[model samples]
Target chain A: MTASVPAIINEFLTGSFSTIINVLKVLIPLMILIEFLSVYHVMEKLSKKLTFVTKVLGFSPSAVLPLLVTVVMGVTYGAGTLMEMNEKEPLEKKDFILIAIFFFICHGIIETTAIWGTVGANVIIISAGRLMLAGAITMAAARLPFFKP
Target chain B: MDPVVQIIKTGFIKAIKTTLMLMKVVLPIYALVVIIKYSPVMPFLERAFEPAMRIFNLPGDAVVPLITGLFTDEYGAIAAASQFDFTAAELTTVAMIGLVCHSLPVEYALSRKIGLPAGKIVIYRILAAVVVGLIISRLGGVLL
Candidate 1:
């Protein structure tokens, strides 16, 4: 029984270590990219272009950056961006809900596109569909009287 | 540098930085999946996901990706998709459905943070997922 316990413990340690290592591999590069984008202000231009769509979805124009990033990056990255922006300029609770709804519906574009593409699907269709649906849902939710902040 | 050149240079650097950060997070997650697949824990996880798979008309093995995507993130689901032999329609349907209802844990936590009822958030998302999944599957068939 003692021998079995050691083996089990060893297996658990190895499994967890590898998991952490793997996640780090993906996370570090993603962070570097995000930092660069923020420093260079490329997202500013993109946000301007996305403003029209976001406004139609019942969100403020400022929400475009976080919304686009959330879909292109991942949830944590998206939320991190929002938190950072919030520090500089706080958003209304309604705006936060809109951003959250958008991110919850879609994130991690490269991974999703690649997976679907690998399976012979049209990446554009999948991407567009997600964006539209997420936008629509957020807009509808925002319009509900009960959801007003 | 000229103003145009300066703009381009800065943009390029920023793009590269963003890409690298994303790659860092994605790569480790992939490695973790590889380890899980090799470990004895995978079978139990596979079993745990079977019921969820049934709701989507997928096999027991498909449960792993769906559950992974729902809990951790979609990258895990994408990795799971890599192991399947899905048609174009199937792929689109699955991706759409996943986009609608993926990342339950994160969403749930976020909802709780916002003072939304955890149960309500989960139930609404799950219901939305099912509705979207069925609609997308049908639409995929029609489109493809």
Candidate 2:
């Protein structure tokens, strides 16, 4: 049995709407929490604490803002901040790639939560796997001759 | 102004903005997938994509979300996945791939804007996602 055009459209509308509803349930609260955290300067403290890790990752402490913001807000926000940093004072190419690798694997808490959590994916696997993989990849990439800064 | 009110106001506005941004990607893919299901192209495409997806122990239908998540966003992938019947492990693999690499075009553009090589970033991200998906699906029970 083939579905008609109208049926397809109906399915599309309802399907997308329902997905939006489901995603929003998790995303909205997290967005709110992220906003409040930033509003209360929690991100600043978090960024500060991450400085040691950044240094170990071969990035200057200034990379912290992009790293933290990306983890919370997504790639665009982090890129925006990185662009700003580049304008003020450029980051090393090695640090740039490392940060890119990190954010590429694990950015946007709301996005990860909504997409994975709504589908019954394991929280530990999604979160821990990405972090561990990102770390491993960045470490390996750091060993590359092109990455020497 | 009270601090509580300020937090609520800021959070509410941010949530609305984020939802709208997600809708931009999710709604279109949702419509596209719905239309594709009615069209004849799905079967041929499914057959072509199925072999690759099997490595992750996913159904042919899982290709929809994987491709959607690659070009668009994870929400679009989630929307596509919702239409199918997948086990928890399969869902975890799909979600893991989405987590590792989603919204590639936009992200690559962002990477370029930040002065990184777009092609390199895109290649690395997709490769990482594939490798991670394979590992997760194979060793999920033991490691996870």
- Give lDDT: candidate 2, residue B87: 79
Q: Write one digit per residue (lDDT tens) for candidate 2, span A31-148.
A: 6777677677786788888888875666678777888898777766677778888889888777777788788888886567656777677777787777778777776776678765
Error of 2 at B35 (Å): 2.6
Candidate 2 on B15-77: residue-level lDDT in tens? Answer: 788889888878877888877766788887789988988888877888988888888877878
Off by over 4 Å in 1: A1-36, A119-121, B1-60, B106-121
Clashes of 2: 0
Q: Highest TM-score, which number? A: 2
- Candidate with top lDDT is 2
Q: Write the per-residue lDDT of candidate 1 for residues B1-144, one digit (tens) a residue.
A: 665555556655655565455455445555555556556776786688767665655555565556667776665566555544667777776777776677777778866754445666677667767777776766776788
Q: Evaluate model 1: give its TM-score.
A: 0.66
Q: Note the residue pairs that clash in candidate 2.
A: none
Candidate 2's C-alpha runs over 4 A off are A4-10, B141-144
For residue B43, model 2's alpha carbon misses the true position, in angstroms, by 2.6
> What would the per-residue lDDT of candidate 1 be over residues A1-149, giving only the tens digit for each residue?
22255555565455444444444455445545555666667777788877788668887777788777778766666767777787898777788777776666667765456545644567887888777777778889889996755
